[model samples]
Target: MPSSSVTISSKCTILPDRNSPIIKTTLKLSVSDLPMLSCHYIQKGVLLSSPPLPPDSLIPLLKRSLAATLSFFPPLAGRLSTDAAGHVHIVCNDAGVEFVHAKAKHLFVASILAPGADVPSCFKEFFVFDNTLSYAGHHMPLAGVQVTELADGVFIGCTVNHSVTDGTSFWNFFNTFAEVCRGDKKISKSPHFSRDTVFNSPAVLPLPAGGPSATFAGDEPLRERIFHFSRESILKLKLKANRKRVNTEILGKESNDGWRAVNGANGKANGAVNRTDEISSFQSLCGQLWRSVTRARKLDGSKTTTFRMAVNCRHRLEPRLEPLYFGNAIQSIPTVASIGELLSRDLHWGADRLHQNVVAHDAATVRRGVQDWESNPRLFPLGNFDGASITMGSSPRFPMYDNDFGWGRPLAVRSGKANKFDGKISAFPGRDGGGSVDLEVVLAPETMAGLENDVEFMQYVS
Candidate 1:
């Protein structure tokens, strides 16, 4: 397809990573959907009890930081631009924030500034609608990020495109932002944006031109809408399932009684194994924990709905391959069954089904069938229906801790704040008490109330 040069700017404000061919591919595919996906970099600052720094004084530094960050990662200079025929393509330094616009007014952005600014409230308000680029993507940010400062507490945020980078990648740039602000040239790792392992199908058949358009119908059920579940609820459900046999009650023995009445109280482990040579011991443990949770659910269609975290294949798909793969490496693996269906079986039987889905996503299945899986809905059955729900989680096994910004550890840093969209789930560190993981499950107002009213959903109240 022929394309035109982008119109963001004449000068090359940003440059592409010379080593990344995948970056080239990402830029190419993003073109048709260009306007819909230009990335944004929002930098906010908090003033202490001293004084409020004028937005103008901040603008120069902000622009410099923005320019510096964009310099390190060249793709920021690129934009998905459209042509007269309405075909879109990528253009470097084509379009960017026209700060002169009213929407980009001197103080169009709200502040989390002390005495008056409320961080959470500001976030809620900003997130109530489509952000600056709302019309651009379904992944609208929290409407805006914030810079908060007060008597003792302090918090600053920057939220941007999920398509361009994962949560991990977002933090990568954020930490670097802090380093740059503090005048530290000591960056540990240079950014990687190569996607050698992620193969795009041909726009034609047999190949998966994996992108927004390639999304599968049946599998669409998984990503159509993802619902959040707190780790507390998961633990409660776990204990409820094992109430009869275990001494410690996550929900309570009575709760277990309710779970046990379903049917077959026992079954075989779903014959699945993930014993690859590269499987880290910790990943192996987490996998085992996931299997255990599935085992206890007893997905029988009436009580429990086993949940699974579908992983993006861009990173781990090929270890021998480069770390970066542009476009969506996101794959949906729903570890679930109809609510009524899950309640029919015992703990072990339910876990097996979940185990099967988990094991089914080995590198090869995803590599060999990525295109078919996303392109052929009837055959793969991914995007089959609308209003599907997914429960998401991450693996802490990868020696990946410390999202250390120059300020010290983010008193409490976490992602999964997806809002407006139905059935969205966000799980982070536990705010306080109990286990290592804390989950904040956000459902529709009705679904939340329903979960609250349901007998099976109220075990982990402590």
Candidate 2:
């Protein structure tokens, strides 16, 4: 569908509830938040099946509930403030958030959810703040929501500053908004807005006059597709990965016994492997994707490939953080291997590499990463600069389908073209609520074609 298929009807600002006691305050960007200053706003939305209420009533209800929701999330209603020293802080001054009402009568829900159909490019228009950077929050609304009424469904899209909230906080705010829309006066979980508990001393990193440069322009042409893996397929991959590990362990033990017999001694084996460790479903799926993508790209065998996984650090911290802790608290850890080794080895090897990297990012490792960043602040390089890297963001564990908003549950979830680059994959849970997973994969056009035709990858794709 072309962009002209969607037309905006009205645009307005939604402020916090006037009766709420919302005092203006300044929140200094924590170490986790500062890095995302240069990143684009996180744009995600849900596609709900046709609602019982018409647009006349639905739009007003969403707008009213959004105002009520903003009262609890003050920073979202605020603007970014840069101090004289170049430090950035969120100034909660009731600036309000942008809300847009649109109509896409030509589009239907079936066109979007059709099997083997490419995601409509015009979905980007469903969101506000099309290519705006996080720093733009200094002047523009820190967040925005666009509700585009489809012929048979409604698409509620949200654009939030990456510097202000991560996936956890993002969903939390959405869930609260839905709760208010459902006539709930009190939210189940209130956001914890204190950065003091996240770090001991806030690090000061002055920005240049021009602000941070964009690390990823996303100029390269790419193809985005959603690959759905059924529960059976996911279990198959997990079983294969675990079975490979067990067989490898047995082979290693036999080899060690043979070596001991030849040496006529009972010396300990070389490096002991963790026998009880099992590869998780996520890890196994990632491993398969990594190998398949590498093969599809058909890079040189000697070339090095890397998989970057974004790990949430809330529970990894020593003291641990409240589940409702707001803002960014994620670290991207990269697992690297040569193309030859990655393909020559079994799936367990790649999954184990990813599993080990995730396991090694403990509290101490997280602290060291923060300290290193404080020493030299830089924006996240949100792309495959090397042409052989895959960066995974978001998670299947997020409660994506829970945002009912007085309407029925979402039929599907989609994201806008924010921070998108080749090899950038976002995971969402299957709508059926099983062990299934959906990967929103972006790749070079040719590579995507190769992957679509590659039997090894398509065999498990449902």
Candidate 3:
């Protein structure tokens, strides 16, 4: 089936208020910024207010509200540049963010939000993407916003350069824009732009010849599918993971004290795997997904599989960072195990492994990770990402659905096709605003087929 498509109606640049004093400032990029230098913008498609607005009126309101919001987020209005010494930095020169107005002729909110929906190719036209900006060393706008008019709704597509901010900061700018649209004069949180907080003691090392190209050019055929996990299903998974630990505790202590013993005890005599620091819902979900994917792929038992989770470093930093420190504050941590071990282990085993990895990242670990990046600024090896590896991104914890622009919450939130990479999984909060999880998985076609039919996998997803 041919995917539904969109048509571009108009394009313009949205700059900060011209009357505002423009400060000439440059934010020096550090080693931590090297991984995201490939001009890969994080794109999101949000279904706007239920009652769609007329194009003429909606466009002006969007433009006006965005301009007002940009005043608070100057970095989003900036551009990317490199000094004569070849060090990349963000020049806060108000280069302006690209704003495009589009019309998704036959597409509606339900069409785009439906599970297993294949978005049209032309949808990419809604956002700003220039290969030259990343590969050819040309200056690129830090942000882009494209609002598409649908028959019964609106699709607001946003793109932000990964070098400038991570998912948290992106949502920060987005929520603020929504606030402005709702006629709020002041935003709830102001972004902190002090890079000094995350400064590296040792200076960043110089880049290698040709300036570090981490972009992966591949021809492997892949497909993406979105699976929904409801609140009940997530609870079932959590229970499945915790049951093993609870059983072990009971058998060890020979006590049937129910939930009280599980909660009250520090997991000493019970022989429970430290329920005090038990596996989280996110960890349980990732573990199940990893195991399911591995089983579906039927990877060679001898091969080692890696699961890398993107960790938010705001709280990991010693003394903690300001809640609103704007920039890329995420790092990836990988856990490796043989396919045989992953398949042979119970669901709780994988959950425990993921939980341990999260527990390992302390303030010292975060500092060491920064120093390690300083020594070697190169991106993680793409060769290691075979069918056997899985990388998880975009935590459900991100407040993506909270952007209410005088309208109600988003009907659906989704990532652009540009984000579909092999062995990648993106998690978003379920529509109910409850504790459910929605997972978008991208994988080889054959693997996806197996996952679709896998009885064990289907049992936990409703």
Candidate 4:
């Protein structure tokens, strides 16, 4: 590689004990690596500071914190290796961390590590690449945490394995490291890494495997797409659904006014929204969106829709389980729908059909199906999902904002690597349980343009 045309001090310092951890095992890595893919339209942000620790000392402090924290996180014993031995080096060079300022609706700064910083040469294969979006995500994470510097700024980016931990777990680790650095009293929440105790069976998804599509088709690199829906538009859609009658006891009867209006405008599919015993707020959203979107395009007569929500089966473990369990203990619950049903009238009442489809997996379904579904060589999921869209995501509820890690609430929570699947939607919290949902809608560029540019949708987006 050409010497960085952008020059900086070549002299770099390796933090203390950088070489201290002995590798119990290592995955052989190839220098030739696939380009890291970034289709996630959202970029979550957090402010990091190690006060009084100047640039020079920052490296040592971070490495020391990582090392000490590892004892508590034994799973990373051999998993977290460096590209170089001894130190997980830091480049103080100008190229090390860069920042850029731009004014949009508000002043914003973007930060990242330089593309080619001197990462440890001894690095293992796991940490160096992108997280695989293939169907059932991997339980093992490639802790390739890098502070990259982009043209505009410096930010921490990595391919965190979704199966190993959820966003809360990921940020939780960071907070603990910070506490360790400050020499705090103790890690507030004890982490669970005992695979046997923390994780239940099948360990993956697609129990029994086969059927549908084959092994995950190569993912089309993610394309940035946004869906514009308004707080009112959402409310309108709901209020018009099931008469003045609603589970409004939670959202209030006024909220369901839109459900009544929409049902009045287009009757038939309006009743289901009122029934609350089945599905969740998030799943209900998927079901509703699937119905609305399908109807929005049904004039063409040839399309289909499926609703899926990231379901946390952690509590579903046999005989019930504890509340503190950590790790990726969820799956995207797929709710099947035919285009005809989704697009037809009274989409609100029809929405419950989605609620009706979910069959939560028990131990039998998991052990016999999930494990075999993932490991079997002959089977995989289907790829030719024409006009099919999925909303695959776990809730961002578990106090992700509470993670101080000695820093503070993250300004944003981002998923750099999304599921390789197309037409995927991710959900995050809306300020303080007013029960808002945000989406990163991935779809073909043109189809998305049609929706985003639509006047009604623009109102929705705002």
Best by TM-score: 2
Q: Which regions of candidate 3 deviate over 4 angstroms?
A: 1-3, 18-22, 49-52, 116-125, 130-138, 199-202, 205-214, 244-275, 380-384
lDDT, residue 229, model 2 = 88
Candidate 2 stretches with Cα past 4 Å from truth are 1-4, 19-22, 244-276
Candidate 4 per-residue C-alpha lDDT over 260-292 given as tens digits, one digit per residue, 9 for 90 to 100? 322110111111222343333333455555654
List the candidates ranked by lDDT, beginning with the highest.
2, 3, 4, 1
RMSD of 1: 11.5
How much is 106 displaced in model 3, in angstroms? 1.8
lDDT of candidate 3 over 1-462, digit per residue (tens) = 334566778889888866334357867665555566654677876777544566787789989998888888887787666667666767777778889888776665565555555444444555656332232223556788898777678778888877677777888899888888888877898888777766433454465655555455544677777788876565556667766433445443422222221111110011122235666556777778889899998878999888877777776677777778778776777888899998998988887787787667667887888877776766544322566888777766667788888868888786775545678787777777566667877888898888888888888776
Give the alpha carbon lDDT tens digit for every residue of 191-242 in model 2.
Answer: 9987775543456766767677778767889999999988666666766766
lDDT values, one for every candidate: 0.35, 0.81, 0.69, 0.39
Number of the top candidate by lDDT? 2
TM-score of each: 0.57, 0.91, 0.88, 0.61
Q: Could you tell me the lDDT of residue 428 within candidate 2?
A: 83
lDDT-wise, the better of 3 and 4 is: 3
lDDT of residue 125 for candidate 2: 85
Candidate 3 to native Cα RMSD, angstroms: 5.8
